[model samples]
Target chain A: MLVLSSPSGAGKSTIARNLLENDKGFELSVSVTTRPRRSSEIDGVHYHFRSRREFDNLRANDELLEWAEVHGNFYATPREPAERAMNEGRDMLFDIDWQGAEQLREKMQGDIVSVFILPPSMRELKVRLQRRAEDDAETISRRLANARNEIEHWRDYDYVVINRDLDRAYQQVLSIVAAERLRRDRSLGLFDYVTRLLDEQVD
Target chain B: MLVLSSPSGAGKSTIARNLLENDKGFELSVSVTTRPRRSSEIDGVHYHFRSRREFDNLRANDELLEWAEVHGNFYATPREPAERAMNEGRDMLFDIDWQGAEQLREKMQGDIVSVFILPPSMRELKVRLQRRAEDDAETISRRLANARNEIEHWRDYDYVVINRDLDRAYQQVLSIVAAERLRRDRSLGLFDYVTRLLDEQVD
Candidate 1:
């Protein structure tokens, strides 16, 4: 499983989107949230919007892999899809925050490869946030404050990518995925492959 | 440091040579060996040829990072060059056996990224060995036997690449190097970078 975490406007979302589009083996782990879905959001695509009761039930039943309560709403990663993806030999991409990445790593330490992305500078980050023009100045101020907190946990990740250039950051992410896939412990097929090699006639 | 280890005919030497030629940041850790230098081999380029007395002196003085006596010829990696390369912010490549890899790892556990290359099949390995026509059939047979012993320790490596296609395996290795460079623990600059990010004024 690949967990991608970054502060808002760090270009992680763009990189994640590109990875999903380009790599067939990877499927995003759509989160389940108790927050009201916008008209632009589709159920099971953007998030599986659920009632507070249902969210509580999932939490009680241990169906949530990692969860957080933010802005009086619950957001969580459902356990079933992630387990299924791993069993099926498909890579699962977790588009989450630092807290979510931490929870997931705690649950699945050996399986998780977490990456944290950082903006090149605070000025560039503020510019990117303002470019969206979706938030008011107060909201932007709150986000910048939140970003400092989020970036503090960059050391917890296995890899850190500075998003100075979108393309370069994305390419670095791709390279990381490729390299992690080649890790000897993860390649279970190597056992039988090596055995076959040893048994083969080499005369 | 990148350590590439493989049994003979697994294409590791070719990949190492290619990496040096293609990447400016990497420099091969030319080993010091007590073996007789071939007519085609250049001193200090292929290896730093030394006498048994000199090799023993270096070993006694603890100047060797990793060393092995192969078929009675002393082959050893000098510690100074690798330390110098690391201190200078240049990547060093170690083309060594499993024993040497283990020694190097012990000396620089956090810095060394070890990879083991495997040929697609034992037959293919034998074919490549034969194709070289440099060694007699007896020598080829001995090498094939030795390869099996070497391959048994593949589990010790961080990453394993099966060399079915030379170019593809080489590319995988290149990707590993790129990703390892992005590891958060390895990037010492990140501490100051993150500090700067947090301290910056955002209006």
Candidate 2:
């Protein structure tokens, strides 16, 4: 499992989108959220649009892998799909915050590879946010303030990529995924593979 | 520092050669050895051809970072070049056996990234050895016997690459180096970079 976390406008979503499109092996973990879905958003694709009550019930029942209340709306990752993905030996990608990442790490120690992305500069982050024009100046300022706090948790992550250039950062992220997959402990077939190697006769 | 180790015919040298040719940042740590130089070997390029007395004096004076006695010949990595390379923020590659790798790891715990290469099969390994025709039949048999013991040290490495295909294995090894360089602890500039980020004002 790969967990990617970043403050808004740090290019986490862009990296995730590139990985999903290029790397056929990764499946995104569709999160469930209580926020009202915009007309541009698809119910099951962008997020599993859920009522606040339903979201609470899932959280209370321990059916959610990780959940958090953000700006008065609840968001969570459902446990079932992620578990199924792992059991079937498929890699899942999570575009979550630090809290959710920490929860996933606690729940699946040694199975999670977490990366924190940072914008090259706070000025660049502000520029990116304003360029999107998705929110007002007040909201952008609020996010910028929150970004500092979010970056504090970067030390907790397994890898950190500074998004100075999109292509370079994307390549770095791809390298992390490739290297982690080849880790001896993560490659499940290696033991048997090595055993078969040992048994091969020399002529 | 990066250490690549494997049994004879496992392609550690091939992978190392590819890396050195392609990656400008890596410098090979030419080892001083008591073994006689082959006709094709250069005095200071392939190995630092040294007498047994010189090798012993270096070992006794703590001038070698890691040393091992293999097949009645002494091999040692000179401490100064490696330390200077690391201090200058350059990466050095060590094409050593498991014993030298273990010693380097002990001496430079966090700085060393060790990779163990494995051939696709024992039969393939034997074929590779035979194809090289560098050793006699008796020496080949002795190497084949030692290969099994060498492979037992696979679990001690940070990364393992199965040399099923040269290109694929090379890519994986390159990916490991790229990702390891981006690790939070290894990227020394990240802390100050992030600190400056936190101080930037939101407009």
Candidate 1 scores a chain A TM-score of 0.93
**What would the per-residue lDDT of candidate 2 be over residues B108-142, giving only the tens digit for each residue?**
77888889999988888888999988788998888
The residue-level lDDT of candidate 1 at B29 comes to 97
| lDDT, candidate 1, B1-203, per-residue tens | 99999998999999999999999889999999998897778999989999999999999999999898766888889999999998888899999988889889898867889999999889889999999887889989988988998999999999999999999999999999999989998887889999989999977
Give residue A19's lDDT in candidate 1 (0 to 100).
99
Residue B144, model 1, lDDT:
90
Write model 1 residue lDDT over A47-121, tens digit each, in one string. 999999999999999999999976577889999999999888889999998889989988876889999999999
Candidate 2 chain B — worst ten consecutive residues by lDDT sum? B194-203
Candidate 2 per-residue lDDT over residues A51-168, each given as its tens digit: 9889888988999998888778888999999999999999999999998999899987778899999998889999999998878899898888878889999999989999999999
Q: Least accurate stretch of 10 residues (summed lDDT) in model 1 chain A?
A: A66-75
Off by over 4 Å in 1: none
TM for every model, in the order presented, reads 0.95, 0.96
